[model samples]
Target: MHQEGTRLPNEPVLKQKHKKRPIKTLFLEADEDHVAYQDSTNRFMKLVYVHEGYDLTQPRHQLINPHYFTGNYPGTDNEELWTEVLDYIDANYQPEQVYLSGDGAKWIKNGAAFIPHCTFILDRFHLRKYCKRAAVGIAGLDRTLYQWVLPGQMKFIRDYFTVRFNDLTVTASQLQSLKQAEKYLTNNVSAIKDNGLTAYHGCSAEGHISHYLSRRLSSRPLGWSSAGAQGVARTRIFQLNGGNITRFLQAEQRQASKQAKVTKLDRRLHFK
Candidate 1:
């Protein structure tokens, strides 16, 4: 197999662009996996997928024509990644509005710059996670707090936390959890409220990362070199995207044979 020197396999490219068409609503989910390297450091393989929407008719909800992009797209700013997603969207579908859902990571939120008429939504999983953390040991308050989140009643929750810390006795660890939850909620209050207002099909980026990335990349007790991990990720994506490995290898072999002949001919001419 021909491998690029210490680099990932080329990023996946569509052989032929999808026929242009109009789509009313589109869903995008972005997330990353923390992959451990043999050198004891970690790298992130970012993932983003675009789908028309979910199909409720199936017993298990399925995405309609989902296209996935995965790689160690190095950088804190995800403009390049989002630009690819935007280009795919523009080529395939004329979407009136695009809804991007995630855990409100800055990188995920940065997608707004590239995706026009986009709305950012905080996934319920993270919202519930922090809400439960904030209301830890407050008997039924977690449920209440979640309901409050739906209506954007964050101030009440904040005031309740303030009162608890000031008037009530709490362990240092418990106070830390509360503080963390408060900070998360405060930072993403708008996203939380947007979740309530928008017609959201819940974000499954976490589940997708588990299925697509974790199972192959980081599930077992194994470490990989940066290039090896990236290569595996790109292969996994190719397989997931329905690429035929046998046909691909045959094509590569043919191309390699042709390149070899060209190089041989050039060497003969130089020697003469």
Candidate 2:
């Protein structure tokens, strides 16, 4: 955890104590999976961070597990879990900017509140799903219209809101649904504008969740133990974040070097 935080030097610390360096954005996504244990159910929530444009040479993360906490199935409140994850990030990876993207989940929304300065964007694909569903309800679910209008309407809705979001209100019958969609675009309006809505912007986070986590764990109805689930989830995250077997070996080498130096110092001090 300490190493994670040290990966990016804090601005205040750098300015006052150490020289400031560039801080990259951390793209984060989280989801909960229901795993059945022999006696009780375990709700395993996995959180992953992908440093923007991370490559094999410049690895940004040392650990890649979703911070896991145990709770009952279909639990109502996840404040504690969110708090723990946020605290972990705050302590270890003091990111200059955090970009969170995910499906509309209550816990995800609540988790954003903990990181006040972090920018939040909705998963673009998920946003399109909502738009398609709404359009289908209005335009009827005919196969041809579903295919044509869904993509076109999604683009239209995104553009329309981009220009006139502030002027709009929740007039749809499903007010709750509309609000959830609005939160993503409206929460960080300037960031959305600056970042733009190109295919590359929001899709990476969604792809990470879909390809790395959901496809393997949540695709089917399976159960997991809390410890086992977290361990596996973390391994997957590390692999996705470019923390492969070679990186682990490199980290091990660095740790051994540091330990050996400390041991030599101790022996010298004892002799003196």
Candidate 3:
């Protein structure tokens, strides 16, 4: 068992480095799960993945060779996570382009700067959310917002909201909602436009969070220590990546045994 506050090292799922190959397009998606610590405070466990588009044969489209990284990373560690992702890309496949989809979080966008030939695409979930909230009063407004987005005419939506917010008749609550939606749209203008690009595949970060992180970490009634949470998350990802937990454990045991014997031999030689 890990001591309280201890964090397990973030380990990659691959035992051996990927054999380099060429891929025309790669998709990267990221999201975070808010989990409760034992003391009741919450921490965001961020998850990021890279895949070779999707497998259409599956009833539900499946990612092809998705590898994940998860942790309660903050500040510099967040950069490290993205760096590791870039390293993985460089080591494995030579992709002509990489599309990163997320909710326009600053950390997620930072990845665009770190990786070459990377473009940021805002996920539809957050876009729809802001559109709904901003369109609370008008019937069909949500649909209208999405329509404008589809054709890449974000300025129409912005101008419409700006005109409405300027009206003295609008309520304070309505104005607040409009301002928030506008802010989100403005900050992610490039990402929003990139969504229409043919190379961009849709994002399933939320679904992944539910399946990979929330199922064990937050969906339950239990609170976890820092170490326990990270451990469970890593182990879950390992299994999802087709790792056999039993084999991994047995390998770890053998490695530990060898290390122990080496230590013992060195101590005996030193005493003599």
For candidate 1, the 10 contiguous residues with the lowest summed lDDT are 1-10
lDDT of 2 by residue, 4-77 (tens): 31221111121134333344555565555544543565454444343343342535432232332222223444
Candidate 3 lDDT over residue span 6-35, tens digit each:
333334345585578998999899999889
| RMSD, every candidate, angstroms | 2.7, 11.0, 2.6
Per-candidate TM-scores read: 0.88, 0.47, 0.89
lDDT of 1 at 117: 82
How high is the CA lDDT of each candidate model? 0.81, 0.49, 0.81
Deviating ranges (above 4 Å) for candidate 3: 1-19
Superposed model 2: Cα runs more than 4 Å off: 1-20, 24-26, 32-44, 53-97, 138-200, 238-272
Clashing pairs in 3: none
- Candidate 1 stretches with Cα past 4 Å from truth are 1-19, 266-272
